[model samples]
Target: MMAKIKEFILLKIVIPIVDMMMGMKISYWYKKINKLNSLSRDKITEWQNRQFRDLIRFAYEHTVYYKEIIDKSGYSIDDFTSTDDICRLPVLTKEIIRQRYSDIVPDNITKIPHRKHSTGGSTGEPLRFIIDENTWGYVTAAKIHAWKTTGFHYGEPFLSFGSSSLFRVNKKNRLHDIYYKLRNAIALNGMNMEDSICRKYIEIARKKRVKYIYGYASSIYILASYVKKHNVKYKLNAVFTTSEVLTPEYRQVIEEAFDSKVMDCYGAHDGGITAFEIERGSYFVGYNTFCEVENPLEISTLYCSNLIDFAFPMLRYEVGDAVVMDNTANTHYNGQIIKKIEGRTGDIIRLKNGHTITNPGFTVVFKQFNVKAYRIKQLSESSLVVTLVVLPNFKKEEESKIIDTIKKYAGDDCEIRVEYIDQFEPLENGKRRFIMSK
Candidate 1:
């Protein structure tokens, strides 16, 4: 009864008041700033380079981890003549962050208050990290930029299919929830993606008149499928997919269902929002992050330093994701801008027999077979279970061809079993894993 009363009071009272205050603050900044849309590529590049140098120097001076490296190598921040100099620094990985979390933080800025963030164990291990309040603002600004590209107005209503840990619904959470509802978004718990739950999602969007939709690509695809099959109509301006790789097939379904173009955005929890679509159909790297593509081919890794996250300095932090770069000449910078992003390093699966295969490899094989959706499960040392949602056009001959391809890639001795299903099971975080190891 107390919980019910709290929910009513917070949702009906406290939330509306907070939302108005926050909205006014954001509006004030929007008015003071010059329009970013007016800036040319050269102007943006110039701004980003200046911010990059400052961040690099700050990290070298304050963070013990980066300071030690600079001192040991007898190098100063001045040695970094260009962004290319970043390559000279050692690549930072998740393991490194986990092991030396304390040392990486600056001693001078001790006890910096930060907001906690959690990543779904999509790679079989969940990770928790912290970012400063200002870093959070930078993320919000990136979202605003992306939304503007999609024709969304400031303070406009949009739906976001994200997660929250605050179950048992207290007053604070209830208030937050109501604020989201008023802003035309409903935060569906990412941990649940059952058909019934997804139905609720569709219902909310329909009622709220949400203009744009954004969330994990996999979850959005699932919701798109539900909308298509049910013939549900919701007038949406655009769909922005993030966090997971947006496949061509998923994009098609989502576009058809929502009657809107699907745009892809890429970022990480560690304060770097570097990619967004411009009015032109091409993606522009946001002015906030200094980004570099370490290697591009079968797998591409991104190295970035956040200009905004001064509290926790991440200089040349290697974010482990693969990407494809465009052939365009970056006159301002020396490297090509990233054209396409594939999947993460964790998305790749290594066979027991020593053969390493990426998600694209499986995608190629699945497309040839015309499978609707599939998941590859490494069952044992020498066994694989390929769970597929068989399409109406699937045939026995196609199955044989798929098996042959799998055997060729995985080796002759490996046991390959195919299982057909109506649909793939959803992960706890509302993501559908295309591959899993058991």
Candidate 2:
């Protein structure tokens, strides 16, 4: 009875107070540490290998699913001592994780108490996942690191144009909102990026003296176009673009309008920062994970192992985005190379006529025509609406060439309409989706 009473008191009072104090301490330390240079590639690799081994061992011993796989493969946890040995393990896919979520996660670790989140099914199938206290810590550290790289100081006001669930914005979201506000970051829902909303965002940034702007690359580009069209003036330290492909043309337009250098960051819901742009337009892998670039002739997929996620071990998880790596000699331990993320797997358009094409194919065609940022929407079975944010000096002949290219690539039966707009629309979550099917 006494123990039960003590447990109740701890849950009702002591734990809440402890959580708040710890959060504050972590936030303070995060701000301080993010400014320091990240671990060198060698140290980062070593640390990741150690963590990978530990996570694999833990999963093998505690998770029945992993145990079965390991036992069948005739390999003990000790076999995975080096990074190269990771290739021997079967690649983890989203389908496998979704199908066997409970079995994949170790039973030993208690779930961190928090609300669960489901991905918006933007990729065709919505995925449900748990987000706990540790998830927030890793996310916070990554964001802080990315911002610091682009000269964002802690407590400096900034703007985030991303989606927030309606329920999250209520009293329940108050604590998280307060934490963001304390960091001087405003959460402007990405759904409201129309002309009026874009104007309001500009007004807020100018008024608040927001030093940096970060959001979906497409969303930021839309706002940038609006700013350029209206001649809005607001000096910014930098613009960090994520959650969508940051094409070179998009980067150029954003830099021109915002008057700040545009940096790109790549990550996902299952993992934290995989790559971030540093000086000289080079991308450096983040510290908490080790990644391998499997380069085919035309495309590459990044296989990553999370060094921190012991609760849910992801060994050689296939992050389904294509990348281009630099072919230089010993720069960093794991081949310090730049990554050009070619968008996600779901960024493909399936025609009603039973043909499928990817965003990269369209991108290649767009490059051939030298068009500005564009989006393709399949409006009907035989029709496609291509919208382009017209660049200054864009020619009619070039537009015709783009239409012709689409006709050739998409097929002769499909009717392609090219619309020149001031800017393309951004999604509710601040993602700039290039291909949308209706």
TM of each candidate vs. truth:
0.66, 0.69
Q: Which runs in model 2 stand beyond 4 Å of their true positions?
A: 1-40, 111-115, 120-122, 165-167, 170-177, 296-298, 326-338, 345-438
**Every model: Cα RMSD to truth:** 12.7, 13.1
Query: Global lDDT of each model?
Result: 0.61, 0.63
Could you tell me which 10 consecutive residues in candidate 1 have the lowest summed lDDT? Answer: 24-33
Give me the candidate number with maximum lDDT: 2
Quote the lDDT for 404 in model 2: 73
Candidate 1 Cα deviation (angstroms), residue 23: 15
lDDT of 1 by residue, 175-285 (tens): 456554444455554332445656888777777667688876766877787788888877688988766677778888998998997888777776354576543234566
Show where candidate 1 strays beyond 4 Å: 1-37, 110-113, 120-122, 165-182, 190-194, 279-281, 296-299, 327-337, 344-438
